[model samples]
Target: MSNAASAQTTKTPGPGTYRASCHCGALRIEADFDPSAGTTRCNCTICTKTGWWGTIVRPGAFRLVSGEEVLGGFSRTGAGYSHFCKTCGIRVYGHGDIPELGGEFYSINLNCLDGVDLTGVPVDYLDGLHDTWEQLAAAPHVDPVTAAKRLSQTS
Candidate 1:
């Protein structure tokens, strides 16, 4: 193949790598994803309490850079484990395999990202509390997708 074509094919993709760390900087992780694609906010009990703004990425795309010893995990939903920094008690990300979401995935907490600004990024709310993971939740307290569909049908 031509030299120019070879270089073009070998060049790495640009501008999406992000560095994230816990509050005390004990744990760190790196991932590559478009910030403009927005994040997901689930209305599940644990998510509501912990304030997780998640960016879903495949397992291969997420990397744990350091602090393996200090990392702790909690499995509230049984679907995945929410990993946190034991020192700072901050949830940095989660790992799980859900068939509905297309197998193994990592949900990175956007709040832990080092320098990325999420000013205008859209937040997709999910009614995980009601197990309606298929459609977006209208609001935190609003009805689940099925309930909303029923309401629409009656109306």
Candidate 2:
């Protein structure tokens, strides 16, 4: 490739990268995604209680930068490995693979991200509580891609 092309590619990040951490910063996560992809607000019991917002990401694009020892996980839905910081007990992110959405995915918590504006992104209200995937798919505000992504998560 030409030097100019190489330089240009190097200068531009593939999508945008967001940094997230537990409340105490004990655990940090980094991910590359299109923030414009929008975020999700589920009415499910766990999500309602945590008030956590997330954007679906692929496993290969998401990462944990530190605090592996302090990280812990819970599986309320039996589909997602809901991880948190053991030190401060803040939900960081979740991951899982389901039969519905082809394969695995990462649900990166937007609330934990730094230097990102989530309000501008669209919001999808998922009826995870009721497992109404079809209804969620039909919602005008819902992004079909993200809906399908989250569908990979077990209930």
Candidate 3:
């Protein structure tokens, strides 16, 4: 197993083995993660439109097993990269800076998860849509300006 796989062994759902596919199933991905670990829901425009339930994890924790050739990306003016299946248009995952986004870590779309039980995980919402950049920057442990700038660049 990879390090990402090993990290999951320490948590509940006993390190879930999850698979995510687009609406048409043309694009598929498999990941091993702990769904019980809490996720985030952002109030940003894109997130609201897509109804994203997000979880944060290191890049190593995720792997694209197949259909990479069919994947597509969407980025907003001030948001992280949103990846989806070009064939089915399913919003799969997102990568963004935390703290400034009212999170302590990066964000991932929980809907991408396949086998983890998310019923017990806590969720916190961030007012990304209306909050000022300065307020967002004031998050306890993150630099809002930097995050904002990064988000802008990606979008």
> Would you list the rank order by TM-score, best first?
1, 2, 3
Worst 10 residues of 2 by lDDT: 4-13
Please tell me which model should have the higher lDDT, number 1 or number 2: 1
TM-score of 2: 0.74
TM-score for each model:
0.75, 0.74, 0.63
RMSD of each: 12.7, 11.6, 13.4
| Residue 89 lDDT in candidate 1 | 97
The order by descending lDDT is 1, 2, 3
How well is each residue in 94-120 modelled by candidate 2, as lDDT tens digits? Answer: 999976755799898877775443434
Global CA lDDT computed for model 1: 0.76
- Residue-level lDDT of model 3, residues 20-127, one tens digit each, is 655666666666565556556667787889878776666666667677888898777545677888887888866665555554333456665544435445666677
* Candidate 3 Cα misplacement greater than 4 A, ranges: 1-14, 96-107, 131-155
Best candidate, lDDT: 1
- The clash tally of candidate 1 reads 0
